[model samples]
Target: MIEILNPTSLPQARETGALVADILQTMRSRSAVGTNLLDIDRWAKAMIAEAGAQSCYVDYAPSFGRGPFGHYICTAVNDAVLHGRPHDYALGDGDLLTLDLAVSKGGVAADAAISFIVGDFTPPESVALISATERALSAGIAAAGPGARIGDISHAIGTVLSEAGYRINTEFGGHGIGSTMHQDPHVSNTGRPGRGYKLRPGLLLALEPWVMADTDELVTDADGWTLRSATGCRTAHSEHTIAITEDGAEILTVAGRAQP
Candidate 1:
């Protein structure tokens, strides 16, 4: 379903967005070498409850994923990209970690994701992968505004990844988000401009750009949730939720420099 937030709803949405951003930043600070994935999940659950908010992933049961994700957040590491279910593994130095989170507060929801290196060690490939996604995400946000087309956003995002020498994957991309975690208007990473849904004020969209180092193909882990690169190459993902306004898009799930 496509949801357009009313002016009154925008406040709640902002609060929810701030909550998601805070949780992600807190998790990033706590995560370190030897930190268990399950511990990260526990921290997410506790934070959500403390904020009096609800986790969108905990009960998320999509056809592509195993029913009832049963986790508060997605903890993707190294080769893992999307829908990464927390496991018993401990993080190691130089591991690329991605944290995707969605939360609801006051009946409004916001979603966001961030990919970062675990410790002081930053592999050039991993850093490049993460940088490409972040740049692409910013480009997508810049292309979004009133009277804009979804294709414009897609084209901007795709151009960045393609120029970075990464193959594009159409299987999953950004989507309209509000009231719930996922919604209509599937925003592909790459597309033609001046096509698809037209942007309007009050519309919320989660723009994510993710890529694998070598292959565009993905393989599901035995856990039935984590999606990894087909060639076991390193991966990175960057996302932010933005609201279309009169002048331009305002990033709701703002983190660091994830601003338009």
Candidate 2:
């Protein structure tokens, strides 16, 4: 179920991407030492509805996760990495928070994620973990372009994580996004270049690089969701939805300014 989007479809994707980015940004801003996770979920829901966009997470029933996620967004804190179900917990200073969001707008879907420290006291390890994922994400995006193989992107992403002394996990990585949140052409975080699917123009891919501080293994929380590091080490994740174009890849989920 690979989806390709032409130039026109890119705008709708930008809208979806912008909504995701803005929501994450807003949530991060509003989040405080005592802010409850449920409040964050509520904020996300309000923004999604206000944008007239549909949440890819709510009512999601993926096999790996508990049926019908029933959440507006993924609120991963500290050890929690992916599929974090919001619970009754208040954020604390220096807590590592990750927000992953996906939304469908005008029939196109865009997904993105961001990790940041909650308050002050940014631990060096936490900052390093977040920086490593961001660096890997940048490398992966840079390797993406027309005529490049999916392996190229994977290799670029893996190199950064490996160089930073982090183990690679292939169970989950980037994937195609359009018309729906997740699609075909699975992009692993580590692979050989010049192999796997050959990328081309009009293809949309969500490139995410995530890593745990010490282990490649993951444990699921009692809730049947919320993947966490096996050793309880800190974690970080970075992601963005990108569209392949004639000259190169266009990142639809950039936060600040538009790239030329």
Candidate 3:
């Protein structure tokens, strides 16, 4: 379904987006070496409940994943990339972790994701990978505007990642997200501009560009949810929920100067 929201509804979407951003910021701040993955899930659950919002993932039982995610947040550590289910494991220094979150408030929804190193150990390559995704995400957002086609956004993002020498994976990419978490207009990380769905005001899109260090292949974990690189190469993911406006695109998820 392609769900669109008027100006008033857009505020609610921003609230949802803010909630997601705040929670991710909080989790990232509290996370460190020896922090347990399950503990992070617990923190997310508490925060989501406190916000009086609903989690789009807990009851998510799509064909691509095991029924009913039954978790508050996705924790993809190191090799893990997408749909990372929480488990009993402690974070280690230099571990690359990706946290993806989505929530609905006032009947509107927003989704976003971030990747970071666990502790003081920041690997240069991992830092570069994460930086590339963020750059691609920014480029995609800049390309999104009223009357612009979705392919334009995709192409903008793809140009950044490809030039960085990372392989793009299209099996799972961005999509239309509004009343529901996932909707129509699957936005690939790489695509030809001037093709696909045309953008319009009131349309909300989640543009995520993720990549594996050495290959585009992926493997599912035994838990049936976490997606990892086939070659066990480190990975990174960056995402944001954007609203197309009459003038341009508005990014719903972003942190203040104090946030890192």
Model 3 whole-model lDDT (C-alpha atoms): 0.91
**Candidate 1, which ten residues in sequence have the lowest lDDT sum?**
251-260
Clash pairs detected, candidate 2:
none
lDDT of each: 0.94, 0.90, 0.91
Across 73-116, the per-residue lDDT of candidate 1 in tens digits comes to 99999999999999999999999999999999889889999999
TM-score of each: 0.97, 0.97, 0.97
On a 0 to 1 TM-score scale, where does candidate 3 land against the true structure?
Answer: 0.97
Q: Write down the TM-score for model 1.
A: 0.97
Q: Best lDDT goes to which candidate? A: 1
Q: Which regions of candidate 1 deviate over 4 angstroms?
A: 255-260
Instruction: Give the range of the ten consecutive residues with the poorest summed lDDT in model 2.
Output: 251-260
lDDT, candidate 3, 98-198, per-residue tens: 99999887898889999999888999989999999999999999999988888899999999999999989889999999899999989999999999898
* Pairs in clash, predicted candidate 3: none
